[model samples]
Target: MVMKAPVADARNGSVVDRLVGIDLARGLAVFGMYAAHLGPDPGEGGLVGFLMELTHGRPSALFAVLAGFSILLITGRKAPKSGIAGRQAIARVAIRALVLLALGSILGCLGTQVEVILEYYGICFLLVLPLHRLSAYQLGLIAAATALVLPQVRSSLLSVAPNLLDPVFNLMVNGYYPAVTWVPFLIAGMAIARLNLNTLAAHWRLGLAGVALAVLGHGGSLLALSSRALTETSLWWSDVDGAFEPSKSSFIVKSSWIAAPHSETTLSIVGSTGCAMIILAACMLAVDALPRLRKLVWPIIAVGSMSLTAYVLH
Candidate 1:
């Protein structure tokens, strides 16, 4: 049996009632980003450091994925519009992207240590426009292809176009968060939204799949680390030593493919994407399992509802 919760009508009720869990998740993502930005450096080696390490790339990945979900919601969820309405919706999104890009550029010039993601995010919004019409299955296929193929493509492109100022190179190769590598997360989020998330069975399946993917992705990284060939070819010994050093600039290895937290490698994408799915599934289950806690969770929901504003202020 397909054990399920009541699905919200696509056209009914306030936005909160339809997707409270998503908003809460967004709030959590924002909080995580704050912790990453303002919290003590994880390289200091302590309880706080360990916690920061755990939150590092995972939270940002969740934010990217949630961006995709938000897009679907804004475009009318599973029932996307056509004709005049569709054109108008696209225009609105384009305007939002432009605004975000402007804000990000302004913020970047301030010289804060924080690597502003808004610029990359704005570009992603525009890049994903053509993909908005794809079905969930189609999006999934594209996401998978991106995760598996894009990194290799990036490595090759980097070999040829090493200049960071090149627009294509910047977006795909060496930017803070390359849209090419991150697009999979966005696509996956949209695909997940198309699923029947208002159901125990669906949640269980998604959660389990997430766990499995995390293990697979992380395990692959570990195996790569252990490989004699890889160890000999790269600066693996220094990288391993650097991993343990307690410095603000020390690398936090989250994937076997690359030790850097935001390397945008294939394994990093897979592992981080898995983490995002797990968080999303858990949020959905929590909303169903703990209805009484809604009052307590209201602050998070409120933060999530105004995420764009909150993100800019932070």
Candidate 2:
């Protein structure tokens, strides 16, 4: 669970000072990413693999959602209060996005597994500008549509030009999440943040609903993939040279929703987003239960605060 930030700081009253919890969440997401990348490969059928699958590839979704949440917290505060302040808020976000994008490019040259997230997140950050203005309902709609459409869209693109489907275009054309599908989730996160969710514990209904949605969403995706036996499609795609089909015994399907060279999949969308909410809610509960851990959360919070920078460095 990300920490609940105070509405404002009592000392200096700066917005940045109020964003400790947000920083913690972002920092932890990077930690998850680093652990997954640095850890030994959990073989396809092993429990380690399952754990890796859950943690290694999915933290980015949390980071992205938090990014959206930040936008709402920072911008919504001033949007209704003063237009000039709102514009400045937007510019702040834009500059951050640009900086991250540039930094991500530099990070990519290091040949690290974490490189793609910086690129993906930098893009998602830019996308938050227009989406920050959307209603919650609209944000939900966008999230749903993108999650459903992106896979199919890439599938279509792969069919049209198989050669172009190479890894060089994975961030845009193929799975885990191309730029098209992921931004909406951030928008949804922004919407969630805009609702003053931290103060709304009185309404357990939203959290309940989120849990239900997550269970159904993730369970349904798993069922769909298991039924299809499209578990590993990389070798098949590579073999055909022009056509792509999945393999029954392949590790790719069970391990990742996106196919390799990039391990992305339709199932990953369900898992990443659903798991994010589940983990967040759980974190919230855990923090409420154990005040002692607040001190422990600092390292993750620091990582979260400087996530983009650390991500670039990683």
Candidate 1 wrong stretches, greater than 4 Å:
1-17, 229-256
Residue 225 miss distance in model 1 (angstroms): 1.1
Q: Model 1 misses residue 305 by how many Å?
A: 1.0
Measured on C-alpha atoms, candidate 1 has an lDDT of 0.74
- Name the candidate that leads on TM-score: 1
Residue-level lDDT for 191 in candidate 1: 82
C-alpha lDDT (0 to 100) for residue 185 of candidate 1: 84
lDDT tens digits, residues 146-246, model 1?
A: 88998777767766765758765685567978887888888888888767676778888888888877766665666676663443222221232244222
Whole-model lDDT, candidate 2? 0.60
